[model samples]
Structures are given as C-alpha cells and as structure tokens.
Target: MKVKVAKTAGFCFGVQRAVDKVYELIDSSEDPIYTLGPIIHNEEVVKDLENRGVHVTDEDSLEKLPPGSTVVIRSHGVGKAVYDKLDGLKLSYVDVTCPFVLKIHRIVERESAKGAHIVIIGDREHPEVVGIRGWCRGDCTVIKTSAEAEQFNPPAEKQVCVVSQTTFNYNKFKDLVEILGKKRYDNNVLNIFNVLNTICNATEERQKEAKSIAGEVDTMLVVGGRHSSNTQKLFEICKKECENTYYIQTPVDLDSEMFQCSSYVGITAGASTPKKIIEEVQEHVRIKF
Candidate 1:
C-alpha cells in the first residue's frame, strides 16, 4: 500500500507558537502557570502540560489563582472582559492568542465601534467566536450554517459586517457570504454588507491539500483532537472526496482492518495536532501495510 501524508498537516504556525511559549515559561518561570484554557484543543498536549504543572483555568477561576500566578492565554483568544477580570485579580498574563484570531478581534472591535452589527460565521460556542463577540462594542451574531444564514434577519437599516472563524471551511465561508449577499433586507443588504474572509491561509492550504489527497486515495485518516474545529473541517472535506475517511485522535484509534483492502491511504492532521502524533499515526499505518 502507498501512504500519502499532507505536507501541511499538523501544528500550523499559531498553534506551534502558542505551544512553544507555554514550554518556554515552564522552563523559565517558578511561578504557578495556568492556561486560560487548554493551550490547544489536542488532549495529548494538554495532558502533557498538566503533567508539567501547567494547570488550566477558566474565566470564573481567576480569583482563585495564587498570588504571583501567571496565566497563559490560549491560541483561541479570550474576550476583552477576560483581560479586565485578569487585571482586577492583579494576575499577570501571557497573551499567546493566534495572530489570525487577534486580527478578527481587531476588525470586530473597529467595525462595531462604527455602529456596524458584527456577524461571525462560525460555531457560536467556539472559544474564538465567543472571544470575537466579546470585542464587539455593539450587537453581534454568530451564524454556523446555511440555515442560520437564511434565518438571519437583522434590522434592514443596520449596517452589517461579517467575519469568519480562522479555522472555518474556506468554501463554506464563501457559500455563507454568498447567501448573505442574496438576502434583501430593504433591497439594500448587499450594499451595507461587509464580508471578510478571516479563515487563515494555513487552514485553507490544509483543506485544499486534504481534498486533493482524499480524492486519489482509497482511504483517508484525519488526525487531531475531537474538539478541534480545523480537524473537523478537514474530516468533512475529506469525507466528501472519499467515503472511507476516519477521524482519529491518535495512533491508538486506528484499526488495522480499515486498511486491509486499501491500496493507498492519505493522512492529514489539524492545526493543533503535534507533529509527533502525526508521525506515530503514519508509522502505525506503515506497519499495517
């Protein structure tokens, strides 16, 4: 069997930078270190951090931190309120929010200040979207699907600005933006609509590469945390191209039987997935072959 692995798979720039910052602090700081959340969606990485005394805390737990504790903001940026709360607690924080996500926050903050209703195209519950919403000075909406896009009905006169989660499927973002363009709120929605494609360049490349590989392979394996949005998007894109697609968090999740009849297999991982995990999965598949 021939095995294909995406060159773009695993740890995009932002995730790598966030992970590196945490490790650096772990080595240099004697203070109690906490991440606002899991540094990345990957459970393996989070568990490793926990082993190294890097505890995970939420917004509600800011007051509970010990004096001199340092909070590390995860790659998924937090809302401005988080900063205020951290300040109120007098705790120091390291902001490792992905630059792509930070850019979206800035855009939302700027546009909302100008009175445009901010519309985010992503899962509402996603930390990044929630953070972006917190930056809006006025009203904000989160739309994740075509149905949501169809059902969206802001006031006709309210100018609307749209941004997407950095990990959102690029094609779907376009489709949703197209749907928004057709909505005739007072027959002037198109003129007032400001759509920004905020999906990161690395995510687009990974998805594009995954699609091409999945189309040519007999089976495809997408590796990442179950909670990872970018990984889920990759699985979706790959499944459409090849029905024999599996989403696995680790090499342990792989079933040798799945490859029994496969002549070619493609492997890809999410942005938060570490290169070691990807390598292990690849090694397991090669052993099976």
Candidate 2:
C-alpha cells in the first residue's frame, strides 16, 4: 500500500504561537501558571502541559487564584469582560488570541457601536463565536444554516454586519451569507449591510487539500482533537469525497483492519494537531501495512 500525507495537516501559525507562549511562560515565570482554557484543543498537548504544572481555569475559577498568579489566554479569544475582570482582580495575564479572531472582535465591536446588528455565521456555542458576540453592543444573531438565515428577522431600521467563525467551512459560510443577503433584499432594508469572510486562509487551504487527497485515496485518516471545530470540518469534507474516511486523534486510534486491502491511504490533521502525532500515524501505516 502507498501512503500520502497533507502538507497542511498540522498546527497552523496561531495555534503554534499559543502553544509556544505557554511553554515560554512555564520556563520564565516563577508564579503558578494558569490558562483561561486549554491552550489548544489537542488533549495530548494539554495533558503534557498539565504535567508541567500548567493549570486550566475559567471565569468562575479566577477568584480562587492568588493575586500575583499568571494566566495565559488561549488562541480562542475571550470577551472584553474577561479582560476587565482580570484587570479588576490585579492578575498578570497574556493575551494569545489568534490575529484572525482579533480582527473579527474589532469588526463586531466597531460596527455594533455604530448601531449595526451583528450576524455571525458559525456554531453559537463555540468559544470563538461567544467571544465575538460579547463585542456587540446591540442586537446580534448567530446562524449556522440556511434555515436559520431564512427564519431570521432583524429590525427594519437596523443596519447589518455579517462575519464568520475563523474555522467554519468556507462553502457553508458563503451559502449562509447568500441566504442572509437575499433576506435583506426582499425586505427592502437598504441600510448599510457589510459581509466579511473571516475564515482563515490556512483553514481554507487545509479543507481544499483534504478534499483533494480524499478523492485520490482508497481511505483517508483525519487526525485531531475530537472536539476541534476545524478538525470536524476536515472530517466532514473528507467523508464526502471518500466513504472510507476516519477521524482519529492519534496512531492508537487507527485500525489496521480498515486498511487491510486498501491500496492508497491519505492522512490529514486539524490546525491544533501536532506534527509528531501525524508522523506517528503515517509511520504506523507505512510500516505495519
């Protein structure tokens, strides 16, 4: 059997930077280290950090920490309220939010301040989307499908601004935006309507490459954290092209039985996945089969 691996299968720039920041703090800081959440979505990476004395804390847990403790914000940016609270408590912290996500926060904050109603195209419960909503000073809507867009009804006088989660599927984001655009036109709401494609270029490239590899292989393996949004999107894309696609977090998750007679296998991973995990999966397949 032959094996092919995606060049874009591992950690993207933002995730890598966030992980590096945590390690840097661990090495240099004497105070106990904490993160607002898991520095990245990968469990293996998080577990390793935990073993190194890094603790994960949320908003409710902030008060438990002593005043001088250092906290590192994860790549998924938090709302302005988080910053205000941290400042109020006089805790030292670093903001490691992805640049693309920071751009969405600025857009929503500025547009909503100007009286525009915010519309975010992504999972409503996602940490990134929740953070973006926090920036909206006025009304906001989160829609992930055409049905939600069709059912939405904004105030007639309000202007609208549309943005998306950084890791949302590019094609789905476009579809939802088109549906919302038509709704605005049909209602004859001539207010200032703005649409921003906030999906990161790395995500778009990874999804495109995953699709291509899935089409050419007999089976495809997508590696990443189970709850990772971008990895789930990659799995969906791969599954559509190759019915034999499997989502695995590590080499241990791979089933040798599945690839028994497969002639060609492809491997890809999410933005948060580590290169070592991908290499392990690739080597396992190449050597065992």
Candidate 3:
C-alpha cells in the first residue's frame, strides 16, 4: 500500500504557540494555571495538561477563581467582554489568541463602530464566531451557506462588512462571499458592501493540500479532535473528493478492514492536532496494512 500524508498536517503555528505557553506556565509557575478553554481542541493535549496540574475554566467558573490566578487565553480568541471581565476580576492572563483571529476582532470593532453591519461567514455557535460577535457594536449576522446569503436582507442604507471565521473552509468562504456579492448588487447596495477574506492562510493551505491529496488516494484519513471546527472542515473537503474518507481522533478509531483492499491512503489533520498523533496514525497504517 502507498501511504501519503499532507505536508500541512498537524499543529499550525498559533496552536503550537498556545500549547507551548501552557507547558511553559506548568514548568515555571507554582500558581494554579487555567485555560479559558481547552488550550486547543485536542482532548489528548487537554488531558495531558490536566495530569500536570493545569485546569480548564469557563466564564461561569471565572467568578470562583481566587484573586491573582493566572489564565491562558486559547488561540480562538475571546471577545472584548472576556478581557473586560478578566480585568474586572483582577486576574493575570497570558493571551495566546491567534493573531489572525485577533485581526478579525479589530476589523469588526472598527467597522461596526463606523456604522457597518457585520456579517460573519461561519458557524454561529462556534467560540471564535461568538467572540467576533462581541466586537460588533451594530447588527451582526452569521451565515454558513450560500442559502443563508440568499435569504439575508441587509438594510439598503446601512453599510455591510463581511468577515469569516479564521478556520472556515476557503472554498466555502469564497462561495458564500460570491453569493453575498450578487445579493448586494441585486439589492443595489453594492456601494456599501465590503468583503474581507479573514480565513487564516494556514487553514486555506491545509484544506487545499488535503483536497489535492484526497484526489490521488483511494482512501483518506482526517485526524483531529471531534469538536475541532477546522478538523471537521478537513474531513468535509476530503470526503467530497474521496468517498472513502474517514475522520478519526486516534489510531484506535481506524478500522483496518476499510483499507484492506486500498492501494493508496492519504492522511491529513487539523491545526490543533499534535504531530505525535499524526505520526502514530501513519505508523499504525504502515505496520497494520
């Protein structure tokens, strides 16, 4: 069997930096450490941190933290309210929000303050999208599909500014944006519509690479945490190209029977996935098949 792995597979820079920050805090500080969310979406990493005395805390749990506690912000980035709350509570925090996500917050904050209605292309319930919404001072909408874009009706007089979730699928972002562009023209609101390609370059490259690899393989494996948006997106892209694609968080999730007759397999993982997990999956495939 021929096995191929995406060059872009595994932790991107932002996730790796966030994970490193947690380990740094664990090694150097005796104070109780907490992450606003799982440092990244990977459960294994979070469990490893828990074993080392670090803890995960959410907004509800923030009030319970004693004064002077240290918190690490995850890469998804939080809204302005989170920072305000953290400050109000007098907690020290190391912000590890991905720079790309931080850029979206700044853009939305500025544009919304200037009377632009914000339209985010992403899952509404995602933490990153929720955080971005916190920055908008005016009306905000989340659209995940071309259908949503078609159904949306922005006030003709109000300017509209569009941005995307940092980890959103690139092709999908473009499609949604294209649909919105047409809607803007049809409504004669072209002059007031602005589109910003806020999807992270890492995400774009990873999806592009995964798609390319999937086309050449008989079966594809997407590895990452189940709750990871980017990983799910990768699986979506792979599945479309290779119908035999499977999404797995670990090697144990793999069924050897699925690939017994396959001559080529491709592997890709999300940004939050660790290199160790990717290697393990690759090694297992090599030894088992």
**Model 1 stretches with alpha carbons more than 4 Å out:** 184-191
Q: Candidate 1 lDDT, tens digit per residue, 160-193?
A: 9999999999999999998988874545554478
Top-scoring candidate (lDDT): 1
Model 3 clash pairs are: none
Residue 276 in model 1: lDDT: 97
TM-score of each predicted structure versus truth: 0.97, 0.98, 0.97
lDDT of 2 by residue, 119-220 (tens): 999999888998998888989999998899889886688888999999999989988887777766556756556899999999999999999999999989
How does candidate 2 fare on TM-score? 0.98
How well is each residue in 62-105 modelled by candidate 3, as lDDT tens digits? 98987668999899999898999999888899999999999999
Clashes of 3: 0
The TM-score of candidate 1 is: 0.97
RMSD of 2: 1.1
lDDT of 1 at 122: 96
